[model samples]
Target: MSDIAAEFDFSMRSHGIALEMQQSNYLNNRICRPLVSAQATLVLESANADLLWDQLRRVAYVPGCSKRLAGTNWPDPQVVADELSAFISQAEVYYRAGEETSGPSAALQYYYSLLNLAKAELLLWRPDAIINQKLTHGVSAVHATGNFEDWRVKPQRGGVFPLLYEKRMGVPSSHLPGEINPDQLFSRCLESGMEYIQVRGKTLQAVPLYQTIVTDGTYSWSHLLIEGYGVIQQNKPSWDLVREIFEELPPLHHGNPWQVFALSSRLSLDSFALLIPCDGKYVRSGDGIHIGNLRLPEWEEELAARLRPMLGHPHGYFDGTLTVSLSDSEFVGLTSDLARYLSVYLVSSLIRYRPSALDLRLNPDQAWYLAAFTRQAALPALQSAANEILDNEFVFLDRVRG
Candidate 1:
């Protein structure tokens, strides 16, 4: 076995005794239950941008809150707070202005809003990182032939884009391409799924994952139930396809594979269940899990992260279900937040610098897609960023009430 896998096995075995002890205590107490759900309901329904702004403001003004949230002490906490507050406030202004405008002008405002928001997020994540240094857009338009498919943007070495990419993915910007095309950006967006099908004639597959408990009378374990597998490829069960979907999942940690095993028998003709083993009997509080071990919440978050390449809101509106998509193409490591940001950046650039090209290409069909993108894309990006910034999952409650 490979060193990593061998080490993982050894660690699992070493924990077996403690796990058994905890399981015994858990059963004797009969109090183990699923922990508090990650989903938070916004009491006052507002725009996601507004919600994010409120959260960011708290990080800025609330003493010691930034350190608590970032998990690190800032050399100059006040400076970081001031910068965060400024950037967030500017972003809110742009977002509000974008909401009041329409057409390419709205796109321009929204792009700037997202850019500022990204900078603020960077500040929160890396309090000591330089933001005032000379930085380019980090991405540039390479081709714009008045066709969305032909439009392309290239990532530069040193810019806010690369910095964001590095911080989020733990990889250098050089790992990305010199240029990215529109189809790549659009195909990754869940909001653009229908548009992708209509334009590219290929369906994007996404399945909701239900969290539940499974047991064999002696031991109970957490499992994620995925239904509608048949819908992926028109009722044909392909193990290769299933593997592909799971392969997209990120590791629970740097060296450990997902502490999840597929119950092969549970793989029926249409659905499947993945067994997600806890480090010990599930505990209500975070204290029970070892700092080095992957916790249940982290497992769920990692699973959700795997779906990052397929851009869109990760949760269902009413049910708050987590959904994962099966890509028809290879993984490009283009997360929804980054892809959406870059896509809008590309559009705004065209509006600002190459208005004639955009005007010439703005046919009825292209305009329809552009309108759809402008309307639906920003929310998901904001929601995703808010989740990262606040270190929690938030579901706006307004839609359910409406």
Candidate 2:
């Protein structure tokens, strides 16, 4: 357990640096400093080991955490605290020897409980972090990312984790990155024992320090869908295959016949393109379709009309053309459904065709935008669509296959 702790701690440090939270000395003094300075000692003092243990057991009520600790329980904190001189010592032993490959251990359970108790205490002063964030447990894992365990404190690819602990703690922030006091935030992380790990610029760790306060595992179907997509996105080659599947799919609505295009060569510069019926010559504009060499103001309105549903109020400037971006919440919310509806097709299409021609690859926003489409169950719907496309194509099969 000590070895694992050491490794996990090391992972936390390395990941924090990679994420530019601790590595950039500038952030510590600027943003993290003030955050950490907002101490929760009084709260922690009020909640002792027994209270902490109870808080951890309460996690069974949390949706995601309950799922992880399926059939696990830890002893009362008083029992362990009375037996051992120090919590860390017994925690180390129980944590190390308690679990095998199959399931979670009592030690692991206690460790999480203690961590959450600390965070829950902090939440007393910094309620912003947990206010309406719907954070479950301090740790989570789904098969899609090939992570049986997710212990990072924040998300990778530019989110508030190591830099601003509040966001990772489920507290959203209005401040930009590196704009807050770094020193206090770093101090708070040390105080709370939260670990934010990133590998090769990817966030691999995000352990929610407060989630251990409960023991509930029930979750919504949406959570399961995202997990499914995470697994589907694991296959690199399948991205391109997903595009092919799109091309071969029949119209989502048979009478509408406005299914997305299959080949990259047939796409337009808008966020997405659909195969519209034309006599022979291509027609760009229609009731719903807005296309042409329009002025910036007109284009902006058109773009807003297209984006308003997904991004509430679309805001952007024209860099020779109209540009738009989604907030983190907006991106996740929109992408989650997109992935379920289009499945890999939406992801593959983005990879195959860019919203703008100048862009070389999917930007951070775009990549994450596509990530929402990774649901495995959606694949069957796509396959059914493909069969319909095949049935239509066979009527026009120019070349015979053996």
Candidate 3:
């Protein structure tokens, strides 16, 4: 019944088609040869079986209704815009470097990147297609994590870059044939979030990161960490301060109102992924697919040692008898700065993936930790970046004050 209901739901979602649900026993009683006909609805034997009828009757098939639902986890348009710009810049640089084969390869990559950008734009216009849309640029996904070697090939599962590249290089690509109109696609992308500028009386697009790059001889997010460390040391933020900071930060308004994870006693340094909690359940989240567990970096031992004193340790946090929470013990010794940065970064990442109120035994100090990070590092950096990303008249602080 659930499987049938889910299929019906998908049909309604994608094609705006509706399915009528009728009781199985009703068919069995009405039809002379009921055994020959398979039932669309399941038959349950119980005193409370009438309740199931109520559920079936209430299954509403409203076209495009989900669009009105708040907190849909749509990918940030700004990230896509910035990355496409970065790729274009890299391509231009490579093409001009006078390298024999490197120039053509970069040019080809840029071409593919533009097509992917168009596809992303199409998704924005047809929001219903977002769930089914596969990522077009694998490289962009790899770039975000900063762990290139591990994530480089991963995006290929949902992206076309690798197969297309291989085919272009005479590697014999075995894929479906789907061509696009470049002019129309580019126009659509412009309608989405792709920005441009005028160069020598000609319109040119693909200037990276809101057209204002911050070159600090480090990764763009590096300052968040550096500032987080420095600010944590200089300021003694109280819980009250933390609460105020939380209220200021944007709320998670997407799918999955709640995520519950019961911890286990098992612990290991070899694994960067969170341990599977026996009683773990993702409530209200769609599908809840565990995508091979999220990869978190192993913090420096010195930093972890610095954070050990302030952390709490409670036994039985996990299902088994344990001295402390598995994550807490594993995450022990983080420097206050690193901890602060991680808390904020992790929260943002979680919210981006599927915004939810987390109910987990691991690292319960995340709330206060996030508060401190927001007060010290997040707000300041966000404000500065917002000033650059937005026009002079619409700075983040001005909006916040308003």
Top TM-score: which candidate number?
A: 1
Instruction: Report the C-alpha lDDT of model 1 over 292-316, residue by residue, as the tens digit.
Output: 1224455445544543433234443
Instruction: Give the lowest summed-lDDT range of ten residues in model 3.
Output: 218-227
Instruction: For candidate 3, give the lDDT of residue 286.
Output: 35
- The alpha-carbon deviation from the true structure for residue 18 of candidate 1, after best TM-score superposition, in angstroms, is 26
All candidates in order of TM-score, best leading = 1, 2, 3
- Misplaced by over 4 Å in model 1 are 1-48, 67-72, 205-295, 301-313, 318-331, 356-362, 397-402
Predicted candidate 3, C-alpha RMSD? 27.9
**Reference-based lDDT, residue 364, model 3:** 32
lDDT for each residue of candidate 2 in 1-402, tens digit (9 for 90 to 100): 122112222222210122222222212111100001111111212212333233333332333332222322223433222222232233323323323312111223323323333233333333344333444432211222212121112122322122122322233333223221112111111111122111122321111100000000110000000101222233333323233322211222211111111122342332222211111111123431211111222323433243222211100110011111112222211111111222222222223333331122523432332232122222222221221111110111122111
Clashes of 2: 48
What stretches of model 3 exceed 4 Å from their correct place? 1-345, 351-362, 375-378, 390-402
Q: Give the lowest summed-lDDT range of ten residues in model 2.
A: 218-227
- The local lDDT score (0 to 100) that residue 370 gets in candidate 2 is 24
Clashing pairs in 1: none
**Each candidate: RMSD:** 9.8, 28.0, 27.9
Query: Could you tell me how far off, in angstroms, the CA of residue 83 lies in candidate 3 after the best superposition?
Result: 16
Whole-model lDDT per candidate: 0.53, 0.22, 0.22
lDDT of 1 at 85: 74
Runs in model 2 deviating more than 4 A are 1-35, 38-140, 144-402
TM-score of 2: 0.17
